[model samples]
Target: MLEIKNKLYNSKERKMQKLFNKYMGIKKFFRLKSEKIFPLNENEKILYTDKYDYKEKNEKNKSDKYLSFNKRIHILSVIPKNKIENFYYSFCNFVKKNPSKNEFSKIILDERLKKSILNYSNSLNLGGWSNLGYTTPKSKELENIVDYFHLFIFNLSEDYIGLDFTAILNKDFNHKLNEFMISEIKNEPNYCKYYVGNKRFISKTGLNKDIIRREKLDDILLEIKMRCYDFLNLYFDLFPLNNKAPITFDEYITNYEFNSKNDYLLRCYDFYIFEDKQISRDMDIIINHNDKEFSQTFLDLYLC
Candidate 1:
């Protein structure tokens, strides 16, 4: 009888010990990755690189005018892997079918450049705040209140792959439009036909700092990803722009790319491809006067 009683008590003690250890494990995890609340600053702050660094920043935020969120939230907008792959495959097929007209397609067809494009698409970083502008939660009602609302701004031209003036379609089309528009307008040299990357997207989210410090921050980031994804989808579907009649290729390209900071040089092929188009056919024709090698290379690529 005594042996049976002893066994019962021993089992109960072991179970209690396991429960205590579980609780302590979670407590320690929170202590390791806690966040701080701080005021906004104009200067840049280094982003968190590791678990230890995040914990250290939490302590630093305890000082005046400095508060840190449990973790930074950044989500890439949905450009699905399958879709990107399909785009590449379709592009390759198009190049094979339309080889003559698409002399510039070789840039995208290069195996090394294509690999780089795939890798960049897989790890694209699309959305996040430069620095958060935080305000105290409006109400004392803890149920409704949050730590802060953060705003993220994105510039399409510099942040994406296969955009800007890199694509042959954009380069050729923009050049043709800019030339015609410039001749018609007086003192307007900066106008262009179409912009390669002049779009921006801004997003916002509210987070519960208390839950984040006591728990894992990955949950908050997951929620942020969903919200950001919706915003991006809507923005892409209904891009807001003022509708206007078409202008010459030079004027069109000039309007968007003049100060866009994209690196591209005007080539003879780019000029020749759009020369026969009706909108730009009236513009004074200019041949590539310099770089005989480049001109010859362009001719060879198109077999012109």
Candidate 2:
């Protein structure tokens, strides 16, 4: 049954749904197949690489801000080889259940939503008041209130495979409307290049700051900004203000290659590190962008 809001958003909702459904359906089918092909006796393990860094501004910098050394601990989750099928379906369901484009766009930019998601992710060192355009010393209650809402698009990975942006896809998928939409994600002018990693279903649970330390969660915070950049990239692909030819994702990437400090840059994990034993409960570390030595050190302890 269509609700009143559904009626209002029907055109866009249907359009987005149609384009994405095929991708979702196909992905769902394969994920289910992966079950028998790759059996699993337990919940999956997720591996991811994300860095977080911040600067304490001094002299010679143009803007008044600096990147923090606090890292994001870029986490990826998997449910188990046996659960891939179920995980993908859950992810697709979330996409279909996603709020209308208008709703998502508006909520994402809202300061209230920002505080809710950020604080829920972690409370320490959220920077000064007004840093996120809100009054300082926000109450946890205010943050939890929006827990009932969806603040962004998420993909829940199942099993041991680390499904991430690095997954393989076409050289460029602008031809596919869903890919086109994804291409619109805003990215910094100089963030690292992203190639098609793989096709996988994904979803998100709210961030658990307790599980991830403030020093590490900071990197996760930055990854959130990178995703915001991803959205802009797709949006620009669909709508361009320039009279001349609109740029491609590659072009946008090229433009920002060296100018990430500008607002146009996508924020990402750049600083901080954490030992694996501190966080892993049966969780294992697989891929990490941090130095191999550091990763190995963590891995060694995790094994011990």
Candidate 3:
């Protein structure tokens, strides 16, 4: 009887271990699939380094390998003027506490805060959104808070593209916020006007909102043009314009423009070098970006 009981216990432990391993295997499969779908930009690749277990690897090599996971921390929310203070303090306190061990028990002190914070461990790997209220297996202390803060912000705002928190996390909060606000003015002029009109909120944040709005729009515009030029340089290098003379970024942008959806499709195919097999495999990415309805549906899967 004793021998039989020991065998049963051992068998059950083995089964549990097998299940855990299987779960991890499935998770890894989907993660790889997602990466293949949405390739990370160069700047983003630098900040995305949490996928691997550094403990098993050499200590010296850990930092190098640990630097490659999420590109930007994005938040897409319209945080109300009344709740800004409460949200900011709650977030600051949460960060200060660094409660990775206790999980969601102390995530938000205010039960009145209705938005459920979501965690996207990998920005590109949009398999599913995990609730911040639960502890993720093997997640590092405070890693989720810093890396996945964007999802929380997404729940807050209804208008405009999400805010990029990458600059803020990298200790360039003020500069990034100014640039973002400036960008917002260009992208949604009316929205920016309304947001900055709130004098009380502007005072509370100590943002250089007035200076940028009044004096720096042209500077921001020039900076944006430079960024686009640089981005095109990278883009052209990755997806060369076949049969066309290698042109300067300025020349290319000035002379060549996508006149229609078909023109864009042709350019996309050129990027893949017109390899039938490769194009067929990666066509979904091209379609998702170019096709407005499908793009919305695809985004809704993750953001909605």
Candidate 4:
């Protein structure tokens, strides 16, 4: 965890040397094994994460349930060892404004947030107005990842084939992924925006007005996304995919109700990120960010 928070992308040698500094002394060996999930920083492109203050206490990542490594970071393969220390700092800082949640429940920068932070004028039009993702994944992977750009991840070891994740590192994402996945795993249909839930297109199932629990809903979305990609051969009708239609991230979470044909939707993908205000009335959804990492809380019902 400390390695991730302060990992240097100077080079693989520097990364390994730094990692070795805390090499578990027998006592921590097994516990440390889990941390060795991905490839060694061959070229160490570690995104600098220290600049921005995290929600946890004194920069203690463990204090933040979402930041916990064992829970999040599901599909990390070998993200290039980047020399972009400022990248991490820049990412974390941007997350301070437009934050996101990892599978472990930690707050991190949205993958697409990088563009906005880099301030490439008119960049919002870049990357399809989605969040952030640096290491785009191979088509075969996205099976278990939450979002390729951020760290939210998942693992269905019991009832699945291979690991799945959002790949933000794949150099050629759209084209290559299309080739590999063909009909198996592909982007949202031409007219769909994913709303998190069963076929009803609502955020909850078999319940009425019980949408306060955003975190649990997030977990449910993971299950749905996995099934949507692996099990369903692109369930287009069930999601909101049209380019003209703006996908509602948590339609049910709002005071406004939804109808199946309204074309309004809810989804976990368009996470609500805020700046200045930290504590939000997440209601039942998980809340992240600190005073500086966060400030006040406000809910703005989005209509694209």
Give TM-scores for every candidate, taking all chains together and pairing residue i with residue i.
0.21, 0.20, 0.19, 0.17
Which scores greater on TM-score, model 2 or model 3? Answer: 2
After superposition, the stretches of candidate 3 with alpha carbons farther than 4 Å from their true spots are: 1-70, 98-259, 263-304
lDDT of 2 by residue, 93-152 (tens): 433443323443222244563444333222233331221111111223212111121212
> What C-alpha lDDT values do all the predictions have?
0.29, 0.28, 0.29, 0.29
Question: Which ten contiguous residues of candidate 3 have the minimum total lDDT?
Answer: 245-254
Superposing all C-alpha atoms, what RMSD in Å does each candidate have to the true structure?
A: 28.5, 25.2, 27.9, 25.4
**lDDT value, residue 9 of candidate 3:** 28
What TM-score, to 2 decimals, does candidate 2 have? 0.20
Q: After superposition, which runs of candidate 4 have C-alpha atoms over 4 Å from their true positions?
A: 1-133, 141-147, 151-206, 209-220, 224-294, 297-304
| lDDT for 267 (candidate 2) | 19
Q: Write the per-residue lDDT of candidate 1 for residues 175-261, one digit (tens) a residue.
A: 332333222222111111234489632211222233232222222222332333333233232122222111111111111121212
> What are the per-residue Cα lDDT tens digits for candidate 3 across 1-304?
0011122223675567546545644644565568768775443232232332122211121222211111232222233333434544555454444433455443554444433322221133223232333111122322222222222343322221121222112224323533443243221111011154555211011123333332243233223223322322331221132322221111000122224454432232232222122223212212223454633111000121
RMSD of 1: 28.5
Q: After best superposition, candidate 1 residue 110: deviation in angstroms?
A: 5.3
Whole-structure CA lDDT of model 2: 0.28
lDDT of 4 by residue, 194-265 (tens): 355654221111111112233333443333333323321221112232322121122122222222222222
